[model samples]
Target: MARTSNMLKAAMALVLCYPLAIAESEDDFWEYDVRVSEGYCVYRNKTFAAYVDYTLEEPCEKWNCYPDDQMVLEQHCPPPPGYEIPSNASKDAWPYCCSNSTSS
Candidate 1:
């Protein structure tokens, strides 16, 4: 009887935790970004909103600066949708890294 009770308990535990695991996968990569350090949202030309990094300085996220124009790109992680690492992107103003608010 004890053995049967333990098995039933184990099965119940797995069943209860299954949904929680599924919900976690919904966001997947983006989910973790939310936890990154909070900062102001950088706007891309007062229209499009660019991506956010967990830092205070410009090129807030991990990126490579193009000494000339001063543009940056996701150095470590792959570029997000629409954010293409440009070969000659102007870093004069906001809207950097070819990224916007819609990103991630």
Candidate 2:
């Protein structure tokens, strides 16, 4: 026997290449950052948390050494129905709302 026919052709080439190497493609590779809880803030992964909550000229930017045990993240304003609150608001406005782009 040729070594059991070359070990059955190397086990049929590892069972036909094992499903193309386990068909992978979870965005191939990626990793933004930013993630919080309680008050909220997710960014990178995007969805909610007011997209990085309040800020003061950049309240801790990403990849910018931001993380003093977490800061800014207590957004809460007169926002409810369809949202609103942006009359030249500053002073690190919380829950910056603006629903339908029809500024009133």
Candidate 3:
């Protein structure tokens, strides 16, 4: 009886931890770098004017530059639950082709 109880506890713990694991994995996919000097933001050896919004195609991220020499980063997260990607979808396209529709 104790063995069965322990096994149930173990299963309950795993179920509770599953969402945390998913959240961590999603957070790990993003990369951030911010450098501000002379009222501008520098990224990848390039300088961006203040109050400008720019995008990076390689990783499909959007960056917003603020006059205070601060930058905000936003990227496409994983598709919603139950969404399905077509077989011929292009991974290089990122958010655009990452997912299509829910499995039916």
Candidate 4:
């Protein structure tokens, strides 16, 4: 009889504490990192320049090491609109127009 009573008490304690344990296991926050690059590349007759697209992923991957689309370069320029060249713009002028605040 004593063994059965102890077993029942243990079962009751587990049942009562299960909800609190599960709630504590829930994730409370998420973290991410933003990456930027000196957006420059040449394609076709014109030079392409602008901040690259912003992306979110697990925090483990370091900058430039992650896949192309996963880096966030949106602070200087946003995406879905790749930077376009202005009319009469010289290739040399491309750097001046598209350059970030600091020079590399």
Candidate 5:
């Protein structure tokens, strides 16, 4: 009967669409608790290497003039001479220094 044929077609359509729906659900993946701190860093091996220098020395002073001598954590890499600096260096917006408190 046509009713049986329609029901079969409907089930076939749903079976075909089920995989596409499952594929879309995978796109919602996300990472949580990604805490980033502002600090100087260098890029090595396709990853950012972080360093914190609180000396308030010459090069850092040029970037920001603050008397507090706060921890200067910037993201920079020392490439070879004449090598172009990467424009996509990571710079954390929230600047935080290493604290004596271990809770960080």
Candidate 6:
């Protein structure tokens, strides 16, 4: 009887923890890709110089090209609740352009 109770408790613990594990994994938003050689990275037929960081306005993403030929892409998430972009703010600018607003 004690063994059965322990097994049930363990099963319940795992069930409660599973969703937390999945959520944690979802927090990893960066996507990685490898290039054929140790040089520049290309996207949409455009070549990005090696060992530099670039931002795209259309998709609101920041990507980096490493000398080792690895590209890391990070897509910026939308502004959180209560966040707003001032009319004067440059939408073309990433991250820095978002600000918290009290009005809504």
Query: Which has the greatest TM-score?
Result: 6
lDDT of 3 by residue, 1-104 (tens): 86566445533543353333234345423334468789777766767775433544455543444434244333354433433444654555434533442211
**What local lDDT does model 6 show for residue 22?**
27
Better of 2 and 4 by lDDT: 2
Q: What are the RMSD figures for all models against the true structure?
A: 17.5, 19.8, 15.2, 22.8, 22.4, 14.3
lDDT per residue, candidate 6, 27-59, as tens digits? 323545646243677655556775344655545
User: Where does candidate 5 clash, by residue pair?
Assistant: 39-73, 39-74, 40-73, 40-74
Model 3 error, position 7 (Å) = 49
Q: Would you list the C-alpha lDDT of every candidate in the order shown? A: 0.31, 0.33, 0.46, 0.28, 0.26, 0.45
Query: Candidate 4 lDDT, tens digit per residue, 1-104?
Result: 86566445533543353333223222221222323244433222223333322222221111111122222111221111233434544433322323332311
Model 3 weakest lDDT span, ten residues long: 95-104
What is the C-alpha local distance difference test score of candidate 3? 0.46
TM-score-superior candidate, 2 or 6: 6
On lDDT, the leading prediction is 3
lDDT of 2 by residue, 20-85 (tens): 322333321122345656545455443344322232223212111112223222222223333333
lDDT of 1: 0.31
For model 5, the run of ten residues with the poorest summed lDDT: 60-69
Worst 10 residues of 1 by lDDT: 28-37
After superposing candidate 1, which stretches have Cα over 4 Å from the reference? Answer: 20-104
lDDT of 5 by residue, 13-59 (tens): 43353333223232221111222334322221112223222221222
